[model samples]
Target: MKLSRHSDYALRIMIQLATSGDALVSIRRIAETYGISHTHLMKIVQSLGRAGFIETVRGRHGGLRLARPAQDISLGALVRHTEGEDGLVDCAGCLIAPACGLPSILAEALEAFLKVLDSYRLSDIASRGRMLRALFDISVPTNP
Candidate 1:
């Protein structure tokens, strides 16, 4: 059950925002911090913004911040929004698929994986705010 890079970036973006609190963070800075391409991060940021997880501001002093509090942003929901609802594998037209339980097993495993993620919010993972801020070399907001 490998998550796509898109989903991975979405999670990273969420964590970055969570650690920053309400402070606006630039995509270019985040890309530089994570060593990802600005173009790729832009795509991910667009997706997240569309999904209402983050808000983007335009113009000279513009940047981005989480749309909602980190405590309200469920990891599972974010993954589902970014990763889509595609099944882990395609059993259609497979030999012996009717008799095979692999599909159900995989489905259950995926459910379990998501269940664990569902139990946490961005704040849960970003609770070590100071550490994360220092790691990213970003100043943590005093009021977060």
Candidate 2:
């Protein structure tokens, strides 16, 4: 199953913040470090904020931070917050809802997928992110 770019970026932002270890990070730094649009990342941050994954601080010395410990945030929860309740297939309100097996198949797969994701926390991914980035020499933000 392929992931959306938005979800990918959100995970990056999470890891970046988690690795920074108490440093308040700004959108521009994240955007520049990841080579993504600050505009797009800002929207993702806003959604994550709304979902209670991350919190935003205002004013001159303000930025963003995780709302909870990295290990407490589940990937399934993050994706649900980012993508909403619609499963992989949209058969619930589809025209083929009368006869298609798409809904059930998607529901089953989605449940399994979420179960797997739920097994890993933000901390798990953050550690993995550091290793993978280091292996590939990817310039992930390691400090504020």
Candidate 3:
């Protein structure tokens, strides 16, 4: 399935924070690393904070960090929080809803996808590790 750019950004943000170790990272750094707009990244940060996935700190040292360990954060949770797709297609406005099995099939598939994601956490990603940080040279903040 094709994930939206927003979903990709959310995953990128999570992976970055997971790999950063102990330091808080800024949205600017994340946007730079992923080559995304700072303004868009800010919106993602706000959404994640509202969903309880990440915490925001204030002041000069203020930045972003995972609310919990990487392993504790599930990819499914992140996707749900970020993507929020209930089905493969937009069936709500579809003219035919009762006859089509598309909605049911899509629902099952989506559930299975989530079940697989639920198997892994941010910690798993961290443990296995990825080279996302090097891709953009994102430096973790020392102060926050």
Candidate 4:
């Protein structure tokens, strides 16, 4: 099943945060990097913050960071939070809804899909920190 843009954006946001180390990232910066709507991202940020995935710091030097370590954030959990419990297809209006087995099959497929996601964490995807930072034009201090 195709994931919603909301889920996609949320994941991107998480990855961006994951690769940024301890530095706080601004929503505008993320939006500019992804070429997404700043207003739309604000909503997603609010949702993520409310769900305890990311922490938002307010002020001039303030920005955003993960609420916990990247390894502690499960992709499956993030997807679930962003996508909610909605089924892949809305078979409710179908005439054969009562007898159709598609819903169950889709449910199983979604479970399997999420199971794969569950096996991964934010750190897994953001492991290529140097590459990601370079790609995003983010600069992190190197150890001497």
**Most lDDT-accurate candidate:** 4
Backbone atom clashes (below 3 Å) for every candidate: 0, 0, 3, 0
What TM-score does structure 3 among the candidates reach? 0.86
Query: Model 3: how far is 113 from its true place, Å?
Result: 1.0
Give TM per candidate: 0.93, 0.82, 0.86, 0.95
**Per-residue C-alpha lDDT of model 3 across residues 1-144, encoded as one tens digit per residue:** 778888888888888888776678988778777689999999988999999888988889888899888878988888887778667788776778878888889889889988998898888776634355555465534542
Please tell me which model should have the higher lDDT, number 1 or number 4. Answer: 4
Could you give the candidate ranking by lDDT, starting with the highest?
4, 1, 3, 2
RMSD of each: 1.5, 3.9, 3.6, 1.4
Candidate 4 lDDT score relative to the true structure = 0.94
* Candidate 4 local lDDT, 62-143, one digit each (tens): 9999999999999999999999989898987799999999899999999999999999999999998888888888975584
Q: Which portions of model 1 show Cα errors greater than 4 Å?
A: 140-144
Error of 3 at 110 (Å): 0.9
TM-score: the better of candidates 1 and 4:
4
Q: Which of the numbered candidates is closest to the native, going by highest TM-score?
A: 4
**Least lDDT summed over 10 consecutive residues: which range in candidate 1?**
135-144
lDDT (tens digit, per residue) of candidate 1 on 57-108: 9987789999999999999999999889877998889999989999999989
lDDT of 2: 0.80
Between the candidate structures 1 and 2, which one is better when assessed by lDDT?
Answer: 1
**Mind sharing the TM-score for model 2?**
0.82
